[model samples]
Target: MQQSLKTAGVLAFQRSLYATDAQFYSVLPHQQEKPVWVIRHGIRGTQNVNKATEKEFSNIQITDTAKLDPTAEKMKVVFDIKFFDLANSLFACAKGKKDKEKDTVKKFRATYDAFLTRAKDSHGLKEVVLRYVRNCTNGRWLWRNLTLASTATITVVKNDETEHGLSFDAVALSRKGFTDYTADELALAELFVANLQGYATDRFRVTALLDFGMPGVQVYPSQLYTSNKPKGFARPLYAVGAEEPVRTVEDVMHFQATRKMGQAALRDDKVANAIRTIDTWYPDYESIQRPIAIEPQGVSLELQERFRIKKASAFEIIQKIDELDPDSPNGMFMIASLIRGGVYSGE
Candidate 1:
């Protein structure tokens, strides 16, 4: 309990909410099934001031007294690990002029024709393939309104009951809104909503401490993205173009057609091949889960019984399930069933 809340300075009220060890481990995904939980446990710097004066605060500083000397003790914890949600922190890959400066994860090097491929076939494929992936990484926005219920507001980092510490991470403002804003112009909830809509962060692994009312309720993330994002989470795009296939891949080949604009009923197979390239979520901000009945877990289970065959790997079955149930509002059930089935798959 003492070690649970380690951040030096947290809010007074937040310092009182502590969870036990048992509660924190409940969410940890199995090692084989675990997704990447990039944990960053360091105090970051931010500027705050008096409400009336709007001046820099002398006492408000980050931990690490070596940096602030006498005032370091006055610094407060910003993000709470034990009580915060990690799902929302997974940012998309950015592809912007700024990002292009570094030739590394620079940008999606799709041919112009490939850009047109997306522009023609998928409704908002252009935005998804281009701008979304281009600037997936660096945007700080959330979806929230001030009038939302306190119940909707989340205390991301609460104070530690057994230790002298506070959390500086973040809280899940219920499912609709956020209690705080990392940016002055945006709330955490608003930031998340904007980000989700703007980019496709559909695949994610959440590592969090769901200290809802218990101690140490750990919820390891099997899938990075959660099953609870509302409809229209994908941001809307405003562009001028028609969607269809290029009958003649002759003039505009894969790389050539990506940016050219045209509309027709027959989609070119070249576009299909181009899609194969974009299928993987990596290298861009594309949604991994499709909206078709891919996996068919129920059918698979029945088949296992009838054929008397050992069940396939839970991951395999889940992928198949995702294929079978693409209609699953981002395939929520498919993901859950996979997590459960794999966790107990008699490894």
Candidate 2:
């Protein structure tokens, strides 16, 4: 009789799809210039709803606001992504209980190897890469910024080679599904698959550009949390700038800056989350009709629900991954989760 597989006590995977923090730039209708800081100002508000008394209604508050440069006609967001070898990206630590350490380790390796072999044989990696490319071309990474743009164009340049790049109509692509693709989108997907599968000499640098046509529209950046927010401020935004003192309300909205460029930016993690929003395999996906970010538990914070309940989570499936069909949705999700990267130790 064959021995049943046991889970590894220390299993970890590194992120295969690495992205850099996206920087913002102000642009004219058809011109490129240095990055500029989004405008920061104050807004006055009055308490109206649920006011306790007449005096409460008169209570006014001041809050900080950030917007794009009023003088510019368009806003440009630029970021880069690097693809890593996903098949051999496991990072295992010490094995399980001493008595079964050797057996557990052996089983773990065999199971993982089988999983990768099946995935590669079935071309599962290509499907995942194509979905990632769909998200990139659709401007889903823009988050709130996507809603503001009347028209948007996304350009994907490999290794900064602008002459050999692909451009897509960001606004035209549907975010609700990933079933349709244009010829250019497929070409981009092929490039990604080639780089990820080690067909390229070196790791490819995928730089993405989002050009929005709205003039002076407000752009959103990753917001920072403060346990004790300054007076008259709603929230703080993530910024890269020189060390300075926070003296006023305007100072709370620190914009990302370099010696020559000042720009609003999104954190790399946020960009990564957007790029991996390809979890349509979740249980609720049929009803939701949209994909959520690939999470270990199939978590969708926006919906405040965990779609993968009970034995459906990546943690549960990974233990018996070798038993799963690599072409199935669940198997594909597990592979994507490994690429997404996280600790999945049984201990």
Candidate 3:
């Protein structure tokens, strides 16, 4: 799922769909055998926006030849966790007397007590991986393997009956690292960094919240780049000689081949090996997700299609995605993917 969504179109498609805890968790590979709670999902930002923005520029090595530092990425990202009482939600939706609500609460209390007792016998958690979708289209854009070293300020939100949830805000400084980006992705990164010269950002994108226990969330990242350009990014000599320049994948591939020949001539094995490993993801943007037999559970796909094409207002689409569906799969994802991938009909 992480590598699946890398295209801008796929991301736009993901922006259209919505899902519930049950539907989302059910789709997980290990859910049927061992179900884990999904706590929270959201975004965070660097405390010092200026420093973070500056680091982004330095990471890309876009400065003059004498000023370029190929490994200058360092920043911070903050996280705000919001928790809710699942038992209370279920009890509230239950149709019956007030006593039934009390009974449900008591049963949940007993179950939690037993669970804690069992959990105590297990070993402590060493690291926690907060999984999240950075952008729906570019599934590979993620902060998955994060190793945190920071303290959090926690606030509890309680209700008349029980302790509802807690909010935890933690700030962790970004680590220095190398990230591989495709040529197109690098172009986008260049565009964003160039645009950042005049812009300031205090916060990052927090598209949706996830409750994969402890309320895990995802946030946008900054200042990550690979040391070398992707394999096929070298422009061709013929294109360089031509009056009108063209930057095509074929040209890049040919340039790389020609350069590899030169490297072989000089016996520069290290540079040639690095060049051979140049990775790219241009084909991903053109991929299409085949329509699945998703059972609709929220707003009808027909109405969603209208909203997607601007036949309906943003408010309407928002309301539709926000609708609760505890039983069936929220077809918003299926419909959005199909439409954006050019595989679905409005009807």
- Best model number under TM-score: 2
TM-score for each prediction?
0.17, 0.87, 0.17
Q: Write the per-residue lDDT of candidate 1 for residues 111-207, one digit (tens) a residue.
A: 2123223223332322222221111111111111112212122222113332322222323222122123333223322332232233322221112
Per-residue alpha-carbon lDDT of candidate 2 for residues 65-147, written as tens digits (9 for 90 to 100): 34556667677788888777666578774585643556777778878888777776466777888889888888888788778
TM-score of 3: 0.17
Model 3 per-residue lDDT tens digits across residues 1-347: 11111111111111111111110111123222111121111223334445565444322211100100122111121122121211121112122232323443344335433432332222210000011110211211113212221232222221221243323332221111113323433332332222122232212121112222222222122212345755423221110111323347766655421111110000122111111111111112124221211222222232342212231322222223223121112222222222122211111
- For residue 128, model 2's alpha carbon misses the true position, in angstroms, by 1.0
User: What's the true lDDT of residue 16 in model 3?
Assistant: 14
- With candidate 3 superimposed using the best TM-score fit, by how many Å does residue 280's alpha carbon deviate from the native? 29
Top lDDT hit = 2
Better of 1 and 2 by TM-score: 2
For candidate 1, the lDDT comes to 0.23
CA shift at 190, candidate 1, in angstroms?
6.5
